[model samples]
Target: MPRAIGPVLVEGPVEVVLPDGTVVVSERPVVALCLCRRSRRYPFCDTSHRRRSRPSVERPADGEQA
Candidate 1:
């Protein structure tokens, strides 16, 4: 199933065929397929999509120590 911010869970030992005619296989009993396309390991989920950017903290000037 697809989640709002996660991968699609699938029963594994599955073979994925990419658009480029490349085939990838996984033999795990379960698999997480990347839906966000942000996975370092494409076609598989590495939880990369869950990462959120943090706001930058303001730093004091060099002469003025915090």
Candidate 2:
């Protein structure tokens, strides 16, 4: 019998039905739903959970300070 996986993490395609009767389909072998509302792919985790690097603010050497 076919059954729904979860809002939890899992592998393989997933079909999500919204309250408005909208159906969202994902065919990824490993699907990650966004819970933090930070994913650019909204509802899909595009590895946005990874830490982002910030620009360095340290000054350059005296001779290289152009």
Candidate 3:
């Protein structure tokens, strides 16, 4: 039998029946809907939660003061 796990979290290849009597299918092993509203793919996880790199620090010259 098929069922929904949570509001946004669902198992793979879940079949969603729209209000218009249309059916939508997901073919992934696991479907993670975007809650933060930052995912480019929307309603799917594209690994966009990774942190960004920091700016590089500048070092002093050989004869620079302590």
Candidate 4:
């Protein structure tokens, strides 16, 4: 199922078959699969989705003024 702030959840131990036929196995009681594709650990959630992108802060050039 989808979560409001995280990856989709599924019961384990699960054997996930990738598009390329690569199989991934997890022995945990529960698994969190990444849907946003932002996780460094593909097919598994590493809590990367919880991290918000930081906006660039524009500072005054050469500190002329704030």
Candidate 5:
């Protein structure tokens, strides 16, 4: 059997196969995968959201929010 190493965080449905041909999946809306094996929570973003620092979008008076 091959060793599998990963902590992939998934926002949608996903499928994985182990070296022994073991399949893994989640029946939920969100999933987290581990990367460095340092995550105590393992996989899920522990407030590690990347900030773009994008300026606030300005909208025209006649324009509707998309």
Candidate 6:
């Protein structure tokens, strides 16, 4: 089985080349892909998190119930 790759710190999206010369694209470090590209989520901060705000509710989308 292939190992899970990374918490790879990068300034932008990176091309991950495998040992076999196959390349995989890691998720864009940006938060909102089309937005201003500044977000609370680091590496790429789209600033969308700044817009999607209700300070009274901190639970993320997964329903883990923060």
**Best-fitting candidate, scored by lDDT:** 1
* Model 1: per-residue Cα lDDT over 1-66, one tens digit each: 745688889998999999999999999999999989999999999999989899898899889877
Q: Clashing pairs in model 4?
A: none
Model 1 pairs in collision: none
Candidate no. 5 TM-score: 0.36
Candidate structures ordered by lDDT, highest first:
1, 4, 2, 3, 5, 6
Q: Would you estimate the TM-scores of all the predictions?
A: 0.75, 0.51, 0.46, 0.71, 0.36, 0.29
TM-score, prediction 3: 0.46
Once model 6 is optimally superposed onto the true structure by TM-score, how far is the C-alpha of residue 42 displaced, in angstroms?
20
Lowest lDDT 10-residue stretch of candidate 4: 1-10
Per-residue error for 3 in candidate 4, Å, reads 11
Query: Which scores greater on lDDT, model 1 or model 6?
Result: 1
Model 1 misplaced regions, further than 4 Å: 1-4, 56-66
Residue-by-residue lDDT tens digits, candidate 5, 13-63:
756565688776766677765544455543433433332378997776675
lDDT of 3 at 61: 81
lDDT of 4 by residue, 11-57 (tens): 99999999999999999999999987889998999999989978989
- Ranked by TM-score, top first: 1, 4, 2, 3, 5, 6
Q: Higher lDDT: candidate 5 or 6? A: 5
Q: Give the TM-score of candidate 6.
A: 0.29
Q: Per-residue lDDT tens digits of candidate 2, residues 1-66?
A: 654232348786988676688888999887887665566775776666664688887888888964
What stretches of model 3 exceed 4 Å from their correct place? 1-9, 15-24, 53-56
Q: Which candidate has the top score in TM-score?
A: 1
Clash number for every model? 0, 1, 0, 0, 5, 6
Residue 52 in candidate 4, Cα distance off native in Å: 1.5
Could you tell me the lDDT of residue 15 within candidate 5?
A: 65
Model 6, residue 21: displacement in angstroms?
0.9
